[model samples]
Target: MNAIQFGEPVSGKTVSARVSPAGGLDILSRNEVARLRDASGSGLHQLLRRCALAVLTSGNLSDEPGTIFEQYPDFDIQVLQEDRGIKIELKNAPEQAFVDGRIIRGINELLVAVVRDIVYISTQLESGGFDLDETVGITHAVFEILRNSRILRPQVDPNLVVCWGGHSISRDEYEYTKRVGYQLGLRGMDICTGCGPGAMKGPMKGATIAHAKQRRKGNRYIGITEPGIIAAESPNPIVNNLVIMPDIEKRLEAFVRLGHGIIVFPGGVGTAEEILYMLGLLLLPQNQEIPFPLIFTGPQQSAAYFEQIDRFLRLCLGDEVSRHYRIIIDDPAAVAHAMVSGIDKVRNHRLDNKDAFFFNWALDIPLPFQQPFRPTHEAMASLALHRDRPRHELAADLRRAFSGIVAGNVKEDGVRAIAEHGPFVIDGEADVMRALDDLLKAFVAQHRMKLPGGTAYEPCYVVRT
Candidate 1:
């Protein structure tokens, strides 16, 4: 397939000239620009460079963060201050982000987002204005970060649907995701995803076509991701708005807070982690009365896959786990209809409770779930994945275990930890460990753990009973 390149008019040759900020990012203080240019050990320039590289290399599908650094070892981006605004000078930038020496408009927008988010977070940290302690403080930080990104739009009804799935999936499954996305779009619902390929990109692609047919204006294709996973799963070109949260925990929080409903596709450990997170949240007694739409769907060929997921949920979280999500197979129209009808209930619930339509402020998220879990060897081993605890607590720990596995598979830090040490050792109750082992073995057998036709996936986890 030919590359989809868009240009904003320039000379015959690709431009190698420096450019200034277009709209939102202009007129930074001299101190801020200096900090951005600093590459020394104490500077924030390294973070800026990494994020900018990820945005410039947008269409590259490999999920490896280190590869970008290796390929462009000397790549450096500096912020330049001028009389009118700020200019970004790229050193060893990717050629693909430019056409006739001009950066593509959408990529430029994303690049601006990269700068905006990194700078905003850095300033917040430097100022010591962000509270990292206490549940309310952490949630406030999340809200601030999102609000700074301009993602929180008030007065809009709940219509954002978050799609969670693996970057690695079968072609048939990917196409099925597009079908579901098309149906959802026809109903005027927008999409948000992890912004990778496979199922992540499929829905956005489908929604664009549907939106075009319906003559919809200002349709949103939002992509929420973190730095660790962005390199491997580069933002697909279809994502018009992109926001990089600080970590995976914040990223997940952004999803639940911003989206009105969720549609999960066929995925591996990452998808499982997402499911467990939502279940853990909804199972809390406070959130029991709240209405949230969740559906597990795929083509008919994926029936057995859903069955395995359903069985695992029943075995681990109990029979009542089935009440939170519905399984719809081989019917995109039915899936969309379910979401439309279900999201209506969600709207009614929010109105009845007088909750904000833009964000789910009432959901109770424990501090453990809100805190970022660094998947170190010791940390992974220390997870309390037993059944003696309350069902919700157990579910949270189970989610953490799977989250570590996902990190081992894709995230750069997690991959390095697995490489340095051995597989993460998970010891839990006998039944829980056995169930975990069975589920992981199935994922490996079905090749859901790795990118299609790429390297074979070896388990990075050792389940002990």
Candidate 2:
């Protein structure tokens, strides 16, 4: 299998390769292969190409998808169906993904994951394989996607902790996340994250050393991402298992369904979006009794950040919402201890409810939470952020508001929309809008919206309080 072949350099370096699958996607039907090869107006090839390029150029710093696309404009990929099995063909690929001539083993595996997920989702999920209309059906679809990716382990206990935070964070905050991850690792807890740099990469980096110290074998450092955001935030090297959900909502659901607990580090609107999503679910009557541990922690410098977050939550969701999460400031060891204790409670709760250890099947995720929220200008403007609605409903809308800001800040389509539409307009009840405005102002002042070294961030939305 001499797959490596030198090709004309697109920018200093380019390589063409016909690589065999690592394990999961070794076989494909003729129709599937055809769909992957079709680069027409109606085919999976463009999506596959974008996702494949993202994986091939993993670890690149810039999150601007346009930057990546412009740099590798001629880069292309194809899924070849040979007599024996399947192989991927790359044209003008990133040189960093290769050593000497062969593709890096881990990159190849992740590339395979990109292919496997894209193909499965395009072919199966869009068809009748999984229902997308109802809440339970959508969740079942999420479970099936994870199962097909070979990530869910039936025998493993609830130990995977989903860490959510901004890819762009301060040096002190990044280090703090690592210390927390090290503590979690020492207690044999695995790490799952968004799989980019900064806070996403820090915990996994810390866990590696602790896992080595404890001789923890088969430690899962999983990274769950989506196609829209994958290019901006490439998969970090520490991510051993990568699964790309179809959208942000699904990606968020996958985190809640697959993990035992969640730990949120200091972040901007994206992290706030995640916090709201989880809290909104927990605020529901059906999910009130479910033992899901959520902690918001960072270094002492980040205490004010969490304070703003806390204040915003109380102002919007009321004082009762504060009970959903514990704010632990500057204490990594205490955070881990609390998580360990909390996870034990999670395990017991699951056992009492007769739920699967690998997936949180018993939790009732409402339909609004399950369905995808497209952050178009109209959609963003139409959000009901007033206090007249039910608390949970209002929380869901708040979650959507932040989610739209997240899109405007990072996602390619969102960036383009802002460029064309001149910022999304967000209007709501005066008090909620004021609190939201204050929180967003803090995020921008702290440089939480863009990566640390990137260009200055312009406001992507206007707040009408």
Candidate 3:
């Protein structure tokens, strides 16, 4: 219930100094620095500091953001304005972020992304420049965020595979993901992920070797994350391109838009939320014809986990829901082969439909799935999880339910809220609740709820069956 503890030992640590931006973020307006320095009640300074710390502490194996802050309570980052550009000053950052007193190149790039996203969001809100109330407006905001991050490639083919799974996966599952990544990479496909550890890192790590073997040049290992979950799931070191969306909604949207095919590794509620979100979108009549290749895969040991997920999906969304994705068990080569083939179909479909290869413009995402779902006590209780509504609509609510659990499990604010206000009461149809409870119980029982070496797992949500 208290602030979740985090970070490794800091004993025998000393201060370090870093120079100009590593990923080409060398300029920021005076206004941006002012906002970043404003640690007051309504300021962005605190958020900036927390996110910056997460980047500097990249490759952290911890899932508790509170622990990171607790370990470095005195850690402070300052945005210094210079005539030519901006310079970030760290008061007590992690020594691991630096080598020979110089900030690591990748970490510096991630740090700039934090500053870039924070400033951009602050500017949008202050100027009333972004219309986030409507579905289209929200999508536009997501697009602009991606564009500003320079992640939208203009001419690249649709080869980016978004690998979604838990950060606390078992070693076998993690190794399996790398093999799949290696296969995908050898065939010239790129990797995109939530940008954390476990499954997220495995694929990127594997691809590096495969790319080297193939003599592939200019490979992109993109890591997309959001502020709320960034600290808990720090960016892994393998991510060459990192972009931080403002929230989970935008992060999910970025994945669905940027990825040609999706490969789901064994995961917990967070992964379920992602699967539900994508399925909910595909279930819509408008998106039924879209050629989006989605596969649920893992090593032989993880077959049961995906089987449980498949059964849960069938029960909640009906047998027809299985049509949206394929399940590949234990075969890394086959999973990669399927993904490569699926991406080819996606390419042809996009070309025929005149959709952008960089972003899937043909796939239509409805308002419910695009808008941010705030996981407050009231909001969580008010979710329409019953089966009376359209199947896609029900899936949206189900996604929200899982999203709330993910927040409570890791997000700092969500964790604090659950601590103060008991567990979140997720009410729904009796049958649906039974299936939901069963799936979540499996997650807890299998030690998938948190990192393996951390504290014992506890349910943050309560299913009112």
- RMSD list, candidates in order: 3.6, 4.8, 2.8
In model 2, where is the ten-residue run with the lowest total lDDT? 1-10
lDDT of 2 by residue, 1-465 (tens): 011111122242688888887878878888888888888987889889888888887767676667778888889998888888888889989888888889999899999999899889888855788889998889988999999999999977889999999887877888898999999999999999998877888899899999999998999999999988888888888888999999999999999999999999988888999999999999999988899999999999889999999999999999999999999999999999999999999999888878899999988898999889999999999999988899999999999999999888878889989999899999999999999999898888888887655567789999997
lDDT agreement of model 3 with the native: 0.86
Residue pairs clashing, model 2: 63-232
For candidate 3, write residues 1-465 as lDDT tens digits: 011122354342535464577764767787778888999988899999889888888766678858788777888888888876677888878888888888888888888888888898789878987888887777788888888888888888888999999887777888888899999988898999999888888899899999999999989999999989888988888888888887888889989988999999988999999999999999999888898999999988888999999999999899999999999999888999999999999989988888899887777887777788899999999988888889999999999999999999999899999999989999989999998999999998777788866568778889987
lDDT of 1 by residue, 1-465 (tens): 111122121112223457666556766777788888888888878878888887777766455548767766767788888776778888767777787888888888888888888888778879986887777877788889888888888888888999988777777888899999999999999999998777888899899999999999889899998877777777887888888888888899989988999999988999999999999999899899988899999988889889999998888889998999999999999999999998899899989989998888988888989999988889989988777788899889999999999899878788888899989999888888888888899888777787644476678889996
Instruction: Count clashing residue pairs per candidate.
Output: 5, 1, 3
Candidate 3 residue-wise lDDT at 244:
83
For model 3, the stretches where C-alpha displacement exceeds 4 angstroms are: 1-14
Clashes of 2: 1
Error of 3 at 431 (Å): 1.3
Cα error, candidate 3, residue 116 (Å): 1.3
386: Cα error in model 3, Å: 1.8
Q: Which lDDT values do the candidates have, in the order given?
A: 0.84, 0.88, 0.86
Candidate 2 residue runs with Cα over 4 Å from true position: 1-12
